[model samples]
Target: MTLTRRDRLVVDARAIVALGGPLLGNNLSITGMAFADTVMAGQLGAVDLGGLAIGAASFNLFMFLGFGLLMATSPSVAHAFGANDARKVTAYARQSWWLVLGLAVLLFTGMRQADWFLPAIGISEDVLPVAVGYVHAISWGMPALLAYFSLRYTSEGLGRTKPIMFTGFLGLTVNVIGNWIFMYGKLGAPALGAVGCGVATAISLWLMFFALLLHVRTHRAYRPFDFFARIDPPNWPVLAELTRIGAPIAGSILAEGGLFVAAALMMGGMGAVTAAGHQIALNYAAFMFMVPLAISSATTIHVGHTLGRGDVAGARDVGWIGIGMCAIVMTISAIVILLCNDQIAALYTRDVPVRELAATLLLMAALFQFSDGVQVGAAGALRGFKDTTIPMALCVFSYWVVGFTFAYYFGVYRGEGPVLVWIGLNVGLTISAVLLVARYQLVTKTRLGAAVQRPI
Candidate 1:
């Protein structure tokens, strides 16, 4: 009962959910870690509390920036698998490791320099030691983090996601426990303050990486890749291909994320309470983005596999289906955020002023939810066709030129304040959706024409 190539591309809800499963697991566990870490940090006094925010903020910027490189692995691996070229898949993975390891070293080295940098961003001297310790502790975890990333995408590339779900739950549990042991003087632990958070997070990542390795080694399908054997030197061609494919997504995400980072820096100057309010709002926004992010991840897989099998029609269907799903999911989230906007904002602070500011910002954020859903889904569709360069350019344009510019204008000069920044995001995202969707259409059309001319 051999399946035809076109039949392989059929996407129903089951397929989409199956594709999104691993990403959802990763999102859920990681979000849990964020919440748990915040809860534990609250017990550590003001200085230590501030330190955790500084460290995580600094690390996330680099982590997400470098994510452009790390995430490039999964789709390439999927493309190779779709083409039924196992050797190419292994080769891509090996090359991806070289690139990821090199960047990991650079990021670790660079993180150490954040101490000199954070104070410049207006972070108080009181938080410096805890912040530096955070940098030191979390920096060393880069290798493990990369290892976990590689294993995760490797699983996804093979159309397997349940393991990621299971592993994420396990890792999150371990992480919270570690936080308890290290942050509060439990189990003969030192109560290392905010530094404890850095230590705990690093250990959690290490555990996830090794556990994934063990899973792949034992699993029947993945066993063939021989993941750890004879990791070869960096191959320039493959590395270049990865950078070409991934840098745009990173740039796009960075643009979106960078605006917030910039806002945080400005908010720091406004005062600790202001920064805290900004962080709380940003955190909620980050959590919300994960839904669209999940949809984007699934879109890439479905599109890539369809294209890999040379099923252009199937690829088209996958793209639209993903976009639709994202719209539906995020619209509902917007409603929830709007209804509970005040209550949600109040969770982070006792100060009434900060709560009011965050509440207003949350409303503005809600307005853009569907727009973000559109842009992310459109980008995911383009990624499916292995067409990235234009989308990359579009992201830079949207985030920096449109998002950042408008944010500064409305947020600062116009006295629109924080609510204005959220509006900027809506503008940028709307433009991004329009541009990327056009690009996706153009790319698939070109491919269809080429395939038709070849005459099966």
Candidate 2:
């Protein structure tokens, strides 16, 4: 019995939601940790808040690179699971552990060197020390965080998102409590200020990793795969395969995230007020971004599953559906941002200048929400088809070549201020949306057409 188009849409939408809902919860919990950090840091004054902004932006840029590389586990494992190739699924999971561990070491080493170059980036003397300490504090947990990503992406591929969500909430709880203790000098601890936030976040990451590890090890649903039953030695071929797929993903993430981090770094020279304001606006925008990001993850899974089952047409449809949903959701988010930008800014700090500047930047954030949503959605869909190289190029060109160049020229050289910087953001995101969506259309058509021509 052929399902009507409406029926198909309904079924696919339900599946996307069923998968995305828990992922959404997880993503929100993850974002909540950062929100807690920002609000708490704001209370300490502009210098502390400004320091955190630069430190976090730098840390997150690197962190996302690691996460992006490990993300390949999702599609790879999803494909195997969809085809009922349980052995292949387990194999991929085990091999990913090795890859993540190596990345953890490299990232940890890199993070520890923040002191060496942060001042070179124009971070003010007062802010530089704070930023470097915060980064170094957080660097301690890199191993645990990367290990958790290896397990998290494996679970995501298996469509077991509840555990991930649960762990995320647990981490958020731990983070808040830890922040209270460390930042306030409670329980015989000296006040650490912004550095305290780093300590708490790092501790939470370790706890989250262990909690997820225990759950994955003991859960009956994961028993068949026996992920921990036997330790598999490093498999170079498997590592290479994951790397091939993930390297482009890492590049794409870095390109886009790098632009934002660069903007923050650039703001450093303007003064603490501007830096703090930018952080508030950027933080809120990032928190809102998790919605479409979670949906994009689900879309990748659904499309990968459809393709694995040899339903090329279904995969294409799933991609488009996900992209449309993201656009609609972000449109609503933009409305909310516009209507409450002042109130939202108030949530971060009480300083009048910071509040006013933040509210202004929120306007720009609202302007780009739709483009941000659409581009991420399209990128997610393309990953499902394992067509990452071209998307990487598109992102780099859009984010760095078009986005960064315009931002530096108009906002810095022209001395136009943060609004123009955000205009550059909007311009880049819009181009990325256009290019990536076009790429998706082309890839789906070519792949689907080829599939149709194959002999029975």
Candidate 3:
């Protein structure tokens, strides 16, 4: 039965939401753990909070690098699944596990050496010890975290997100309870403060990894994929292909993430108040970003699946719909941020200066929400097409060349404060949004035109 255009649009929207809903929930749960860490650390004191902010920024740099590399599995698996090529899907998944192991080793080594370079980067004496401790504690979970990502992306590629949602919530629960026990010194444990948050996070990551592994092993949904049917050794060609695709993705994510981390480090140098305020604002913004991020992930899967079935037009439609949906949702999120800025800030800390500054930054955050949504959504769509190298260059130009330059000029050189730094973020996101959407348009048009010209 041929469906009308409107009917197809409705179906596309439904598919996006169905896949994205669980992903959104999962993303939020992950962010919720961060939120819990921030609030808990804030309760201890501004110093502890500041330490956590720096530590978390550093941790995320390595974590995002690993995540970006492993995420290549999603599109690869999705394409194979859509083509009904189960063997290829299993092959990609196995090679991804090997990639995860290598990333885990590298990340763990780097994390252990964080203290050596942190001071050179201007991490203050007050926060250095706590930050170092936090990194050391969290580094223990690198292997587990990488493994979880491998499984999660594999499932996402196969259009299975409910397990991700369930495991995420479970991790959040474990994180909160662990924080209660270790952060405050309950249950005969000494109060570890910010460092305890790292310990809690590490433990929670392991739990989540094991939970997902158990599910994948036992669930009927994954049985046909033969995920455990055979253990394959390192396949150099497959690994190289994944790296060719994933390296740019890692670089692109790092470019954007590094921008924020740079801002945080700069704020940290200013004072604990500034750092804490920046953390609060950034944390909330990240939480809100989860919605669009989930939609973006779903868009990537949808586009990949459609393309696998030789439907370029369908892929194009899915991409645009996803981008539009992200923009609309972020618009609503901006309004909420504007309306509840103060109340939201209050939830993080009682320090009047921190709260006030955070409230002001939330307004800036609100302003950039739309651009953030559009850029990330567009990036996701591009990932589905396995077109990442150009996007990586674009991100570096937008974020480092344009964004960081402005941030440094206004916030550091001029001492204009966090507001100006956030304005710089807006500039970067806006530029990225404009260019990425245009890139998507160009790529889709070129592909569609070629499809038309093909000899039939």
Candidate topping lDDT: 3
Q: What is the lDDT of residue 435 in candidate 3?
A: 91
Estimate TM-scores for all models: 0.91, 0.99, 0.99
Candidate 2 least-lDDT 10 residues: 120-129
Q: Which of the two, 1 or 2, has more lDDT?
A: 2
For residue 333, give model 2's deviation from the true position in Å: 0.9
Predictions in order: lDDT? 0.77, 0.92, 0.93
Per candidate, the number of residue pairs that clash is 0, 0, 0
lDDT of 1 by residue, 12-104 (tens): 445877889678878878877766776567555445655666677777877876776667777888888888888878888778777677788
For 1-456, candidate 2 gives per-residue lDDT tens digits of 999977998898888898899899989998999899999999999999999999998899889889989999999998888888889899999999988888988999999889997987778777887799899999998889999999998998888888889999999999999989988899998899998989999999999999999999988999989898898998888888899999999999998999999999888778899999999999999999999999999999998888889999888999999999999999999999999999999999999999999999999999999999999999999998988889999999999899999999999999998889989989999999999999999999999899989999
User: Which pairs of residues have clashing backbones in candidate 3?
Assistant: none
Q: lDDT tens digits, residues 397-443, model 3?
A: 99999999999899989999889999999999999999999999999
- The worst-scoring run of ten residues by lDDT in candidate 1 lies at 5-14
Question: Which whole-number lDDT from 0 to 100 does residue 351 have in model 2?
Answer: 90
